[model samples]
Target chain A: MKELIQLIASFVGAIGFSLIFGLHGKQILLAGIGGACTWGVCLLTDFLGCSLPLAIFFAAVFGSFYSECLAKILRVPKTVFLFSVLISLIPGSNLYLAMRYAIEVNRELAMANAIETLTVALAISLGIIVMLVTSQIQARIKSRGNRN
Target chain B: MSLTSVREKDRMADAAGVVRLALDVGEQILLSGGEVGRVEDTVLRICTSYGAVRTDVFAITSLVFVTAVWENGEIVTQSRRIKEVGKCMRRLEELNSLSRRICTERPTLAEAEKAFSEIMKRSESSWVKVLIGSLLAATAYTAFFGGDLKDCLVAPFVAAVIFGSQFLTKKIGGNKFFSQALCSFLATAAASFAVAMHLGSSVDHIMIGCIMILIPGISVTHAVENLIIGDTIAGLISLSEALVIALALAGGFALSQSLFGGLLI
Candidate 1:
């Protein structure tokens, strides 16, 4: 239950933040929910001591799908939804830390942090692409059915 | 008419025509060794007395005319200015040359490849860029005072808030100044809470993360880019925006610290 509440908070935070970019309240709210669920998955994987990379990959893929669904239902742009939802998973701090390390001439630590950040970014980008492809397929099928 | 007298009159008319053309073509009347005051005074007078449309001009290498939208869907364009004639000629020549170049380049795969490479080069490297920025900030903090894992880990929230503010400010439809202020205050207060609640690892850690978020990275980047590209006026505008936002973030932090003095993390 506590975890669930935190997930909700994360969702609210993501949605609230999304509003700054001219996103509609409803659309952002849905994005927040999607982001929250994705974050929950990542948190759970961490708690279970599983590979974080894998968790991030899965979370992104799922997040994309949820974003697409919300976009369809809400009649907003899917790119907006997906990008907003993906915000929850961005390793914003890790990048900051890596920079700090480099400035201080801590080469080893900086390199290590930098590598991890790169991997996380790659995973998220891959996941988003996958989700985009899937959504396109779904859209194609929906359009085809309507024609018949 | 006396020959010398007519010659002097013609020179004066040509000078007036040059000024008019410059004003009409939307060229910055303030050019190399040009003075803005004279152009401004002339424009004001022309607008007031002659019913000529006076425009807000931006100074760069030349005066830039920036009247994209107008009242009641009507756009008033005056073409009698010499500046307008010069600008149109240059534009036409450029367009013709570009078409010729495109045609020639289409057949050369190497040229197309070079064009693509140039486009990619213009965009920043997404992965390495973020990584380097984070690494530098982290190392500075960590080396000054040994590692704090929890705080460092949670610092991203502050980063998020800073980044999030850009989006929030745009979406909220509030005054840009007010939105920035509110965002900074909320971001600092949130960072304080995150640290105090033990949810975030450390105060310093969170501050480092959140502080950058408010740093007008985009505006600063734009200012630098414009300056490097030789658009002095654009660079100035971007720099101003960056300065305002940075001050707003600082003000927000100061206010938060003062309000909850003893309770601050």
Candidate 2:
């Protein structure tokens, strides 16, 4: 039940951001759905005993895939959807904790949280890079085949 | 000689017009927070579509430079300096579609300019919508971050304070970092006060929730994307910007927490 509410919260959060970003109509709803599904994937991976960073990585992979496919179908840039979809996994709270600890002179705790934040950030970016590279390669092969 | 010179002048003006149009599209994309790669690619495509035999484009977060060579080897170079970057996904979509249409249809300069103006005119959303968006984001993220119903309920009021501060800063033409710090400080102070008044349960969750709305997630993602695409300069510029904004947000929150230490949990 808690997970379900969190998913809903993620959806609402995405929708709010979509509005803030000036997305309208169907795009907002699609972004919301995408955000919910991304969080759901993260939760599922975490439930399966995956590490938190690994779970976020998988979630980002799914989110990027979702946005790429949607962009193709909708004839829009992928970032429009990608931004809102991945909003739920940005590790904002952890970053805040790191800042707070640093200010309080808790050097060890701040260093630990800062490293964790960087790791999670790296994982998310790597996931996005993997999908992007794959898509570029696929496009190249398809274009080459057409020329042949 | 006079007749030939007049004709040459006309040709030069025509080529300059095409280059200007292409640069205009690229600038809009950059200003609307499109990726540097996409902005460069779109400019190149648009110039080539308009009969440039060769085109070279260099784009970073704040500037775009393009030089196009015509069939007769005449060259036109143009550059645009983008002063501000803001996200408007709808405008980005419209600009993307406009670029695609220009490439496929090769519209006349007047027609393309008209279309671009129309997109710009429709890009500004009402202030009410933005306020509502802030409220909703603050409330929903509060819940998502483990805030109970009371905390969630209090988050919107705190969000309103942040929104008002942001609006005031914008009106005063304050710098980005100062405005961000002001908004974060106000948000933290309001959240702490609410918790002290028994209007909410947890200050941490509320502050985190409000911070989610202010985080530079899109900029960070775009920076990474730019780096992967080999636009290293643009990537680094944006990455540094994200870091500064994050630091400012933390600074604001820390100041507020210190002032209201007893009220915050």
Best-fitting candidate, measured by DockQ?
Answer: 2
| TM-score of chain A by itself in each prediction | 0.83, 0.96
lDDT of 1 by residue, A39-140 (tens): 888887778886877788888888878877875675443444655466556654555456546645788987887678667766776676677667668889
Q: What is candidate 2's lDDT per residue for B170-234, written digit by digit as tens? A: 89996899899998988889998989888999888888888888888668877877787788999
The parts of candidate 1 lying over 4 Å away from their true place are A1-9, A47-49, A141-148, B1-203, B208-265
Question: How well is each residue in B1-265 modelled by candidate 1, as lDDT tens digits?
Answer: 9975564444333333323433532232222112233334333333222222334434432333422122223233332222210111112222223223433432222343354334334322233323333333432232223325566555555555555565567676767667777766776677677767877655545564455434554344334444544566756765787668655655665676556533955
- Expressed as tens digits, the lDDT of each residue in A1-148 for candidate 2 is 8898899999999898888887888989999999999999999999999999999999999999999999999989988898888888888778878978987999999989888877888778878888899999999999999999
DockQ measured for candidate 1: 0.02
Error of 1 at B166 (Å): 8.3
Deviation (Å) of B148 in candidate 2: 1.1
